[model samples]
Target: MTRLQRLVRIAWVFCKYRLDIFLPMAELPAPLKLFFLFAPWHLFPKGSLDRGDRLRLALEELGPVFVKFGQILSTRRDLLPDDMAESLRRLQDNVPPFASATARQIIEDSLGRPVTELFAEFSRDPLASASVAQVHAATMPNGRKVVVKVIRPGIDRVIRQDLALMFMMARLLERYWSEGRRLHPVEVVEDYQTTIYDELDLQREAANASQLRRNFNNSPLIYIPAIDWDHTTKRVLVMERISGIPIADIESLRAAGVDLKVLAEKGVEIFFTQVFRDSFFHADMHPGNIFVDASNPADPRYIAIDFGIVGTLAPDDLSYLARNLLAFFRRDYRQVAELHIQSGWVPPETRVNEFEAAIRTVCEPIFERPLKDISFGHFLLRLFQTARRFNMEVQPQLVLLQKTLLNVEGLGRQLYPELDLWSTAQPYLENWMRKRIGPSGLLRTLQTRLPSWLEQSPEMPQLVHDTLVQLRNAGAPDRGDRQAAITAELAQRHADRRWRLTLGALSLAALAWLGAEEKLVPLAQNMPHYGWALLALAGWLVLKPGRK
Candidate 1:
């Protein structure tokens, strides 16, 4: 459809579902308000469904791209309201399969061989169909079972069209919505655009599978299918096919005698291993992409598929995240709050006591229940919410990680209701910490870098001599220059202190203004003015330089 026609269709869907509740009427532009007003859907009365349901249904009715969008949004409980997030979680990417003829034609074109030559037998029927791709079961001439994944025909054009509209909507929301700037609608859409486009490339997916398979070469916790590179192409992926019960099929898993408790714990182990151990994880671990290998029912392993999306963290980010998780497990609220500032996740000037209290209030209640009863996903949501209150900036890299954690935790709890994820994860993270930050870790680092240090050792003496000569020319280390350097360092420290005080003053001024404007009503009502004044006074004690 033309872009104009697409806009009209979207408008119809919006009005049909009464999704106008999402828009802040006063914030909308005049022309846009007029356009929606002229739309034809107002004649019919609105349905009895709640606002969240209306939003979910409208996205579902919009087609594959929007269904996937809703699913992505559902993962972001931190960004959306509770009702909306819950409703969006119900969005499913259950698109119908495209024509087998088209799939066959695309395969032949990508591999430069007919389906017959590529595989001894190829099923015309699709094994599964998702928004971006469909899989067909096949067998090679050597009788190796494999599955061929083909990108939907002409999907790129459709995605491009939809993405253009998506960008426009994101811009509007970010411009007009009160929470738009905080929610970062445009960035979210950009992330989705990158992800959906990445999924369109079969070769990338094949590489991801290969890397993950190599990461867990022979481990039994989780299984990633091996890629058949010989027949793989940009638009076509061929991988070893294995039969297993879907992870969501709990009844089938139970009937097959798979040990549910062991299976669930193994799933958690695999998740932590992928994240902390390997620093590479399958971001999309939804039930549809996961399965249980019931061949050994006593020790069931997870079979992972659809490696189109994955997450990796920077070394620093990974370290901080590990520390934060460990602190949370220990119920060290002060340390958790401190870590947020130290990691730059929260503003440096934030009050540790207040932040710690906020965390404790949100999290302490969470630990009151049994491990199986606690929702780690919801815990993360609350943590993110509290961080938002402190003006903590969102880490885009961790978004996928948070989503995968939710999936893994949800699946874990589903498989075994009494699963203590904390028990399973706490020790794993602690062990990782020992290996990562302990004396052994230091020795391991030295061992790995010793050879490189030795390789450059031949120049060390000359380098040292040259440094001494330069220092000698500039006067000895014990001379006036050294005292001058110390004096300069002292001056710099004083300057730094001065700047910090200046920043604190500005922050206090801002806080005073906010208080005077009656924005502190709830806070003042909760605490006397003197204590509230003290709290506002400490606002300037923020560690980081004041933000403009």
Candidate 2:
């Protein structure tokens, strides 16, 4: 459908669902307020269903893109209240499945073979379905169990249509909204576009799965299914079929004698390990993408699937984030505020004392509640609300991490009510911080960076010579300096030799310090003094009168 028609359809859905009440009339522009007053949607009665249900139904009526958007927003528990998030979470795996025959046709065409020839047995019915794809059970030619996933026919066109509308809306919001610059609506849409397009390509999903499997190949914390590359393609995927109890099925897990507490803690550990140690993590960890392998009821391991989205952190973001969380865990609001300004995520001119007070106002009251009663979701909700006062913009790169973390927190709370989230995560953050600062971290840093420093060292003398030449040329008189230049040239020749020697000494000092910092120099002493002496000598050579 064209974007205009899609927009009309969206407006219809919004009207039918009576979504106008969700709008903030007080904050809206006069034009918008007037438009809403005359909007045809006002003809309908106010919805009896609550706000959350109204939103959920509106998204469901809109189509797959809206459904998937709701699914993502559902995981962001921190952004929504409990009832709203719960209502939207139903969109996670409830996307209607496409016809089995159509899926079969896609598989056949993608693999260039008949289903019977490729699999020992293939099931027509889908075992699971999602916005972009659906999966069916099969037995491979090697007699191994597998799942066949086929992309929804023509989903790309549908996504692109919706994405175009999203971009339009985002641009309008960025242009017209009061807080547009701070919120960065267009950039958020851009990141969402990149993420959704990546999901459209099954090969990228396969690679993501393989890398995650390698990240936790043998560890018992989680199990990732193996892919069958021989049968995988851009439109189809065949992978090892795994079976486990649905993570949300608490009663079944209890019946199976699983230790819920241990299971919950392991989930937390697995998430931290992926983020800090592996630096790679499954971004979509809602219960729909996670299952509990409770074969060992005493120590249940998680079975993860659906690697369409993943996240990684830059080394600096990772460090600053971990420190920020650690500070929060310790109730050190000042440290949290300092880390924000220090990381350049928050504005430099922001007063740290004021920011700290704002954070404390938001967080200190939560301490009154028992550990089990405190919600990470609520904490984040308030913290972000406070962040707006300081003009802190959204970090697009952390969007997936934030969503995945909310999912993890929700799952942990579901699995075990008394789970102490702060205690569970604090050590991981502390350990991660230590690893980036301690002796081993320093050694690792040198090993990775020393070569580049050495490679650039030889260019220093030439750089100095060029700078001196530029200074001499810039300092030259327009016409009269030439008479004195002949005499100065003779002196300059002598000065140049000393200047070159000093430059050489300075270069040596750089190399020596690099080695000394890495501790290659045994009992290294006065390395800074040596650098100062070299710098001092270079200054004297440059500043001394040139025999004129």
Candidate 3:
């Protein structure tokens, strides 16, 4: 569709669903507010649907791009109201499949082979369909069952068109709305744009699947399908077909004698393992992307698919996040606040005690409820809200982590309503912390680095000697001072050389010390103070004059 036509359709959808009711009309421009007042949709009888439902419906009707947007928005429970977020969470990617002939054409064109030559049997009908791609079941000549995923035709153009509109809207919101600047609507849209565009590349998704499969190879908690790279292309992906009951089919699970409680606990375990142990997690883990292998009902295994999005944390972030979870479990709000500052998640200048109190205010009440009743997702939401008060800049990297956590929690609750997420996750966090920060962890780290340390050991003495020489020369006087006029030039040149040497030595030393700090005590409480002192000393030395 033309851009103008798309905009008109979007406007019609918005009015038809009366989505303006969700907006702060009072905060909008006077002209826009007046336009809303005279909108034709106002003529229709008000339905029983709530604002959230109306918004969700509008997005769904707007097409796959808007649906995807809603799905992403659903994850930001901290930023959205419970009802709105919950409603958006229900947004599913079940767009109508394109013609099978078109899918075949794309596959053949991308793979450089006809379907008959590529597979022993190929189904024209799609096994599943989504916004960006659709999957068709097929069998190889070797009789190996597989699925061929084809990207939607002209999806790139469609996405670009939709994204332009989104950007325009985001700019408008940031320009006119009071909360827009704080929310960073433009940045959010940009992030989404990057993510969706990445999704268009089937090769990247296949690689994600391959890495995850390797990470969980021989593991019983979850299963990832193997990629058929020989047939995979940027437009088409071929992978081993997997068959399992959809995770959302609770009735089927029960009928298959699956243990719901065990399933729920295992889900929590899998999530923590992905986040803390493997450090690579499938980010798009909604019910649709998950399934249950109930062959061994007592020990049900999860089957994961759709690896278009994944998340990882930097080492420091990983350590701090683990400590934060552990501290929260122990009800040590002070430590939580400290970790946030230490990890640079919150502004450095934030008052720890005040932040601690804010966290306690948000978290303590949640603890009053039974462990089984508390929702980790809601707790995180509250925590995010409290952190915002301290002007905590959102960590874009952790956005996927937060979203995955919410999905895991929701899946757990769905399987077993009385699931104690804390109990399931606490021991795992504690164990992870112990292995990461305890004596054993330290020994392992030392062992890993011992060879490198030894290799560099020979240079240490020379480094020390060079640093001392620089320090000594920085204070040395020019013996040519007897020749007064030339002495000044000689002294300046000498001072410059000495200054360069000293700064270089200091930099090397600082780097060495920082490396040691990382290996020795990654989450050390006093390391920041030591770092500040070093920085202060460097500043003084830089500003200090040489021998005059």
Clashing pairs in 2: none
Q: What is the lDDT of candidate 3?
A: 0.84
Off by over 4 Å in 2: 21-36, 74-87, 90-93, 460-548
State residue 247's C-alpha deviation in candidate 2, in Å.
1.1
Task: TM-score each candidate.
Answer: 0.82, 0.84, 0.81
Of the two candidates 1 and 2, the one with more favorable lDDT, higher being better, is: 1
Candidates sorted by TM-score, descending order? Answer: 2, 1, 3
Q: Any idea what lDDT model 2 has? A: 0.81
What is residue 511's positional error in candidate 2, in angstroms? Answer: 15
lDDT tens digits by residue: candidate 2, 1-548:
77789889998888888887766566678998898889998788875789898899888878777888777766544345678887997764467889888988899899898887998998877898878899999998788999988999999999989988888877876766676767776886687788788888899999999999998998889999999998899999889999999999999999999999999999889989999898889998988789999899998999999999999999988888888888888899999999999988789999999999999999888988887788876688678768878988777667788787778888999999999887888887888888888755755675465445444544544565566555666787553666545544654555555655654554455556567677546524644675456445545554555443
Off by over 4 Å in 3: 22-48, 443-548
Relative to the true structure, candidate 2 has a C-alpha RMSD (angstroms) of 6.8
lDDT by residue for model 3 (1-548), tens: 89999999998887788776666677888998898888887876668999889889888899998999899988876567889998998887898999999998998999899989999999978989999999999999999999999999999999999999999988988887777777788888887998898899999999999999998898889999999999999999999999999999999999999999999998999899888988999999989899999999999999999999888888788888888888998999999999999888888999999999999999888999898899898889888988988887767788899999988999999999999999988898888988897656655675465445444543544565555455545665853344543444455546555654565464555446556667535634555785556545555555555444
Instruction: Estimate the lDDT of model 1.
Output: 0.84
Candidate 1 residue 546 C-alpha distance from true site, Å: 44
**Which residue pairs collide, candidate 1?**
349-542, 349-543
In angstroms, how far off is 110's CA in candidate 2? 1.5
